[model samples]
Target: MSRNASASTRIRVAAGAAVLITVACTASATALDRSAETRSPGTPREAAALTGSAKLYRPLGDDITFTFDAHLAAEHRMDPAKATGTFRFSHYLDGRGAWAEGRIDCLLTGGKVAVASGVITRTDLPGAQGNRVGFTVHDVGRHDRLGYSWASVGNPVETKDLPKCVSAAPFEKVKNGTGDFRVLPWDPDFLKEG
Candidate 1:
């Protein structure tokens, strides 16, 4: 009888532990799901999130040249009529022995054929102070007809950068904007290219 009681107590203890573990796991999963939802589409999580490459070259002013190869993961949005996104880019400057990173809050209109505009912030060149530059991306063209992948040509909004000695700037009073740009899901394609 004692043996049987000992066996029963052991079983009960094990079962209770299992139940507690299950409850803890369920609670953890719920929390993760809620955090992900905050960044979901149309949730006002900095427009859109995307990973891609861009190359830009533009004369900032009469004496300053700004060019960069940008690898960026940005927040983006795409809909039937419009698309938009905000991006922070790691920029490699052109052969100047210098580097800079910056952010742009961009908008494009008219789906595949669109125009884009945004306020840009970048570390200062030709000066030690950072600056705010506005840009307009026009003649947007998408690579996929049914998708939002696109390229555009644009230029600075002003002939010179506005002196703003800050490292980063948050989008001010902007909720969301729309247009069309296709984002391809990431995959390991480089290994297959050989």
Candidate 2:
């Protein structure tokens, strides 16, 4: 074949391969986007890692008391076959006006429920003051997705029965903490109650 004819044929082949590759990539991307959109609204969104703040509440008659703020770190589970990933947290339990700090290390199950065990240290008391100690509680909660979370209902496991804390106190019954995991949005218009 003539040199010009040969060169033309090679260029055509290369262009066809490029077009095929572009089509394949576009199809794959569209499939992934659809899957994300189809996930249950209440289910955890697929993310590499999610970071959000949590608020614990104590039911007090008609009004709910804000307990504390907990920082949450959870790995996103996108695949159905993979086991749930680890979730870590550091929280502060409010002592009326003061507060106590705690930490949690646990893994989620099906991105639904998590039973976390953590210690609460009262560093805001009087006399022995800052030297005051606290106990650990077994917390069970549903991992929140869009705008929902679940927590222990009543009396949590104490240190005496489980020996997980230094001291225990006669505290009121804890209701539940409702929470949500959200991506920090760039648009202010997308904001909602936490």
Candidate 3:
């Protein structure tokens, strides 16, 4: 072939190779993204985490009120031990209050519901010291409510037998302007580890 003709053929070959490489890279990237998207939401690493707090009040007969305050954090999976916060529960009657405080341990959340358990660090509630407590929170917009495992089990004398992260369905309707609870889902993009 003539020199110019040979040079032209080489140029076309190089251009075709460049196009093929580009197309292959694009396809590989697309496939990778699809695989990531197909992961199940129920996977522990992909499961929704619980955060935020809720404080609610329930009126008891004879001028008494029960108050519960829960502060939760389950944002990090890097260290499972970092997934907890504090909780305070109390009952007030005639200006006198009895209370319990503890550290939240296990948290599981899905959709509008979240279940959490903690070890009570201090409390004046009879037979409640150093015991595990479980509760459920339902964030139903303006009608948020909560349920305690002990209450759900008929207020039994002993509650240390309840399982972790287990609670009854939310039943106590939170009074308006009392408090709010939040259940945050994992955002894979933001949570991706390097």
Per-candidate total of colliding backbone pairs: 11, 1, 0
Once all C-alphas are superposed, what RMSD does model 1 give against the true structure?
14.7
| Candidate 3 C-alpha error for residue 10, in Å | 62
Supply candidate 1's per-residue lDDT for 43: 47
- The whole-model lDDT of each prediction reads 0.34, 0.34, 0.64
> Candidate 1: where are CA atoms >4 Å away?
1-13, 25-48, 51-96, 107-118, 127-194
* Model 1 residue 37 distance off true place after TM-score fit, in angstroms: 9.6
- Best of the two (1, 3) by lDDT: 3
Residue pairs with clashing backbones, model 3 = none
Worst 10 residues of 1 by lDDT: 166-175
RMSD of each: 14.7, 15.3, 13.4
Residue 133 miss distance in model 1 (angstroms): 9.4
> What is the total number of backbone clashes in candidate 3?
0
Q: Write the per-residue lDDT of candidate 3 for residues 99-148, one digit (tens) a residue.
A: 77788776666567777777888887777787787777777876688888
